[model samples]
Target: MKLIFYGEKLSNIRKLNGLSRKELAEQLDITEQAIWQYENDSMLPRIDVLNKLGQLFNVDTKYFFTQEYLIHKVSEEKIAYRAEDRESRKKTKLEITFVNFLDYYINFFEQNLLIPQMPIMDIREKTLKMLQETNEDRNECIKKIAEFVRTELGLENNKDLMYTLEKSGIYIVEKKLGTQIDAYSTVTQDGRLYIVLGTVKKSAVRRNFDLAHELGHLLLHDDVDMDILSSADLKTIETEAHLFASAFLLPEMQFVKDFQSLTRKSNPDYYIELKRKYLVSIAAMEMRAYALGLLTYQENRYFWGQLNKKQYKSFEPLDDEIPPVRPGKVRALLKFVLDKEVMEIEEICKEVHIRPDFLSYLFNLETDFFKPYLTTQKDYFGHTEVIPIGDFRDKTSTR
Candidate 1:
């Protein structure tokens, strides 16, 4: 049977590489219009051009001809970006494409093992029911929901937030999302929730806060239409998520008791101990305290002054000391399948229509995962040695 070219796949791959028609054309030695035509199915590329495209994309030539089964199961409009900027739409498109590839990978393992159930679904339903029953305001409802989530997770302390979420079937992916974007969360059509965190060398406290904030979006705003939300409306939503994050990370009763121990309410340095205990930033702790009426307006103002004067906003005391937790759900799952011989790396690549390196890049996995499957050659002593598949991007210039 003859295979037909799928132009939409070309567009997805191009966007995934952060490339534009003009830029890709320049690299392929073709006109911008030609690149556009090929992407829009207006014309087919020559065999040489197709070969070059495969090489540039680090995929088999047949990838372009194959049916694109792996698609963005999660809608971009439903995504809750922590920080949306001018380039957010483009960044979101790329990230969602990456998610589709990862979802495809996870689906491959579904035939062999069962994925865990998402606990957040139950938490959301219970919270909504409670809201309908009570006369609680929005913020009060958020606080109650946060407390309920903590109870549902069986978390006594603030630590292990990421681990607990992962165990509950939320996939936490840490990628180098640029400065503008800190984190985002979304639920796919198949009910898989994802929290894609930006690996910007943040403090553990900040990271935990980001995790909780995304979790808030996943649980609270799952049904909201984010695409039509105006700037002010989005801000309100962001504030709500922030409130949820703060309340969830720092439980009211626990934080209140902890605040009473702080002798100097105006001193930002004094809260470092609380920071150490809760694994929360001093700034966040102070805000949480103030929200709980532990600190007065003047005291909060003084705390802010000292915070800025000392420049603890960017680089806090424990920012370097307390390392952020690395995401392991996807990595662990992939490793399990590989180690169990469920599927060989080479076979997986062929089946997924992806290069090993590209697959690794999607999940931010180390290339060492593929080292064992490298090509082998016999030495002088008849001993077989591994020949590493060197950098895939060495042929193409960096984007």
Candidate 2:
């Protein structure tokens, strides 16, 4: 049965569901050979099986018939910081699906709207030169790199980072990933970088640190094409990203001055006070203190011991009190387009060729969330893109 559909599309949907052909065959009560045939485009699923596939994957049945396949690249290296035990494959599979969804969402936005103009920023030559000269001393290089980025972004100190990034046309999205992986950074086909953050509720400080960490990857590892990175290479890059995040969040000079003022340097309570000012974790503050040479080797060891003894390693004070930050650019863009009657909810769903529920999951929004803004009839055939009326010129700003 030769159907005018992409077999690769079926394969992609199955992979997105994190299912092997045999596993999916079992679920569908079909033979593994049959599943392979469908994915290979040698056979078409019965209408009943197609409906079941749609229901199983939460995609419309038309999705299978659509000729469009995932056109962009998926970077796998940034997500491999995992235990090499039994859960390794499971975690990697989940990460793959998550990246797939992200790619679709990014394509939807970039293909549809043009509000945020993301310009590529690269300083690989200088960063590479400095690292080579410093004997790959990321500790020193990281501080300089962070300071350079802070200066370039005009960020003298801590401010709403997402607001700054969004104004600069960097798209940010928060996923409700409760997995061990906190976040990952990927570049689009057009050289636009998007940072995906994990929305592990009740810790805005951690989210802020994660964004800085990802920003570090985008800036410092500009040379890395994630498709070709090995696990060892990923570990090296991850370490560099961590160093950059630490230095970026708490400037060495500023952190040194602040740490000097702490009366009880070892106390988490003392660090908690700094957390309020620095918008970092009490624990991160303590580590930052050590990093800045504010704590001696003995003092750092003692502080770690204290952290263990006080049961502050996993659970810390103000974890609940500190509200987590969210990415606002996507949400803001949706509001602008929908409210301006530029596009309706059904229109977007149709244009994106995604199920409304799936779109909702991608954005961490409610199902039928856009249903309210849809005042007119469903106009799915014609693409109604909003034209840029006036361009904001001269100085560029993120917020």
**How accurate locally, in lDDT, is each candidate?**
0.78, 0.68
Best by TM-score: 1
Q: Candidate 1 has what TM-score? A: 0.89
TM values, all candidates:
0.89, 0.82
**Model 1: worst 10 consecutive residues (lDDT sum):** 390-399
Candidate 2 Cα outliers beyond 4 Å, as residue runs:
1-3, 77-101, 104-107, 110-138, 156-159, 176-178, 225-232, 351-353, 375-399
As a whole number from 0 to 100, the lDDT of residue 384 in candidate 1 is 25
What is the C-alpha lDDT profile of model 2 across 191-217, one tens digit per residue? 666787776664767777888888888
- lDDT (Cα, 0-100) at 105 in candidate 1: 71
